[model samples]
Target: MHQNTRQRLINNFPRSSAQHLPNTSNANGSSNLRRVGYIEYDMSRMLGESVKTFVYVGYVVEKSLESIVDKKKVAVKKIVCGSAEDCQKNLQEVKILLNCDEHENIVKYYKTETDQDFNVYIAMELCLGTLQQWMEGNIPTIQPENVNPVQLLKQTTKGVAYLHGKRDAIIHRDLKPDNILLKLVGGKVCVKIADFGISRVLPHERTSLTIKTYSGTRGWKSPEILNAHSSPPGNLRAHPRMTRATDIFSLGCVFYYVLSGGRHPFDQNGNSPNPELRDPNILRDRKNTKIEHFSPRIGGYIRLLEQMIDKAPQQRPSAAEILSSPLFWGHDKELNFLVHISNLMQENKSPVIQWCKNQIEEDHSNNEDEFLPGLELNNVGWMNRTCEALDFYFMYESPRTYDEFLTKDLIRAIRNMGTHYETLSPSVKASVGSLPGKFMAFWNNRFPFLVQTVWNVCKVLITDPDFDSVLMFYQTG
Candidate 1:
């Protein structure tokens, strides 16, 4: 840390004087010959009470042959456990934090120590504050707009994906906004997930675990978790299983809170003085899948949240799947995806083309629900009307059928957009430029089913065979 940076961090500490404590044991072997200057906070307003811990700002000082120097700054989490269970939980969090230190989005663990009173002290990288504090206007230095919610959500998803992909998969049972910490890196806001007290590490052979213990905050708990205790014992079918999807549900709520400017999807009026009254309503709404309406500004981003917070845990997308969503794609990436789909459609043997043919056949077989049956390509009136509604440039010669529209006309439009990018309408450019954020709503408004069908088909076909291999088509022609 620079001298100026060190001074700036010191200035942020409360007015109370620092208490110097000598380090007796170096259990982690991370540093040498050190004492910590622990910053004090008022116990009445301490934020770590819920987790049975006390958090403080602390500075590590190393003594050399010459002089003592302030080596590093860290957040010291002290847990005074009253029982064996509490001690085990504290150790679990410390172990998980140390294991996850390599990831940039996770808080870094420096070292751990114990005192004569059996209090566990864990020192980790100090961040500015929690995501809750930032959103609630507690952090005055950085504005909310400076931290792009989309990018923050992407980073958070990456961290969750990392945990799920581990050799022994980890499930963060308590993943709420308060557990996400924020810091400024090169004048840009970066998120760091913290406080894994209730996290569980799954066995190598298992993907999920069923536990009876109730964990996680009320408003953000998944439907399965909320129903865990309600179900009868030994009823495996009714009991909630802890899986990677559990984290995704909480993440969805956090995403909504971030995008909707602190409003929860299940509870619009989250500021109720009585959480007892508010929490049950939120839970009820979540169980019924009754989401509050998001602003039009969020556009199709809500689709991602809906899938994540699905009532059935099995229906929710995995952490890796969430990361692959078009919600995270940039303009260049979206254009590449569209171009790749267009290229695939040109080949008769292409899976994408075959998928479209299959869809047309299925729709035709079910005459009761035929989509735009007998629609002709050269129907200038219908084509113009549809194109105008979709904000698409009309073609002189259109496809003869709806299948042809998918196989030829749609592909031609995508190709033309890429080829004539310079001459396209500003709206068209913006729609493609912002990806699902703008394009999804733009097309969905005109052709809801058609747009969804094409997008889903292309999304799967473009990354064919292996759903894990996301955006592989972007690298191809």
Candidate 2:
């Protein structure tokens, strides 16, 4: 052990637990001695494993002569270095963590310790799991109902922006979902960037450096890094000059995975026209591929991804640019409103009847032109969709009470259909004449309670003069 390490143990440790108890002369010429090694904890539970290390969840006692440590959990990363050269490289990673101050999105660093036997242990705040694991469990389709892609994209971009905006910008060479740690905060999940082992800090100047060592995970490396060796004979110096654009490409892949619910954006498996979905290392002269057959609903996000993973690195947007893009903020407002309707129905029963009615009126007032057709109801395509929603709600719901009918959005949709029907010319209205039996056959067959909800929604059409004639004929029949 070095002399400094020996002193550190002597100064920091309790006198009673020291392996070598130092003797000293007191003021009265009496001898005083101190022993060390009081702090103790077991690094037994294995949390995770990496290329050169094993992370264990453990706790340590501090400022106590007793060997008992509190039960608060901490992740202990044990890095095994066989040679001094390997040890120095590992220490550089620790220095980077130390330099980065507290950031909510970046993994929290606690402290570092080294043993005389050349084992290094770094303790950090514990997280539940990784973003990769979460994705594996919650698979999303093109029309995502359960997952919120907007929230995921916003949080991920925030982390990248912080890293790139630093004085000496840091590029996370391995920015896969697996490196993102997830923690539950106030019933919502948040992500933190972890595993900075292969990260690189760019110099203040934009000058390129020739890095011989390859870094990054498969399917996420940028085109420049993948085609580094394919440069022209005179351009040997261009092979390893990686820039911030590399990270942008990887981030694009991440966004694809989240938005597609776990499908690889570059995946050409199935009917997609892109070549192969495999790693870039295998294809030396690989052609640049584009995202194919993505859903039109997520087109905004897909457009941003296209710009991010562009073949030319210069064309890719910076992290800040991506954060400010319209794609990041764009989400279907109607879909969100439907989600709110679903939640309002599920959480309460008594107040939801009035709530649903108020929401429908508010939505119509806010988007009057959207629900109202230009001339007539039957002239627009939404007439069929409104009828479909009515049919679906009536067929699926087995509500015991009228207030519990699962037709909130559908009710609003049908009301818009009714309003449009009232505006048609008498000649046009006479062409399609039936009223009561046509729209409410399935609804009327329901139990008494269920029939009331549908009756309340259709009552609005009684104000129409032609509809009153049709209703009088139906009521007398």
Cα lDDT of candidate 2 equals: 0.53
lDDT of model 2 at position 272: 46
Tens-digit lDDT string for candidate 1 (244-340):
8888889988887787677666663444324444356545654222223444325434556777877777888888877766666664555555565
Q: RMSD for all candidates, in order, please.
A: 8.9, 16.9
Decoy 2 TM-score against native: 0.57
Error of 1 at 465 (Å): 7.2
lDDT tens digits by residue: candidate 2, 365-416: 2322322223112323222333344334334532322232224544443333
Using TM-score as the measure, the top candidate is 1
lDDT of 1 at 72: 68
* TM-score computed on alpha carbons, candidate 1: 0.72
Least lDDT summed over 10 consecutive residues: which range in candidate 2? 32-41
**TM-score, per-candidate, Cα-based:** 0.72, 0.57
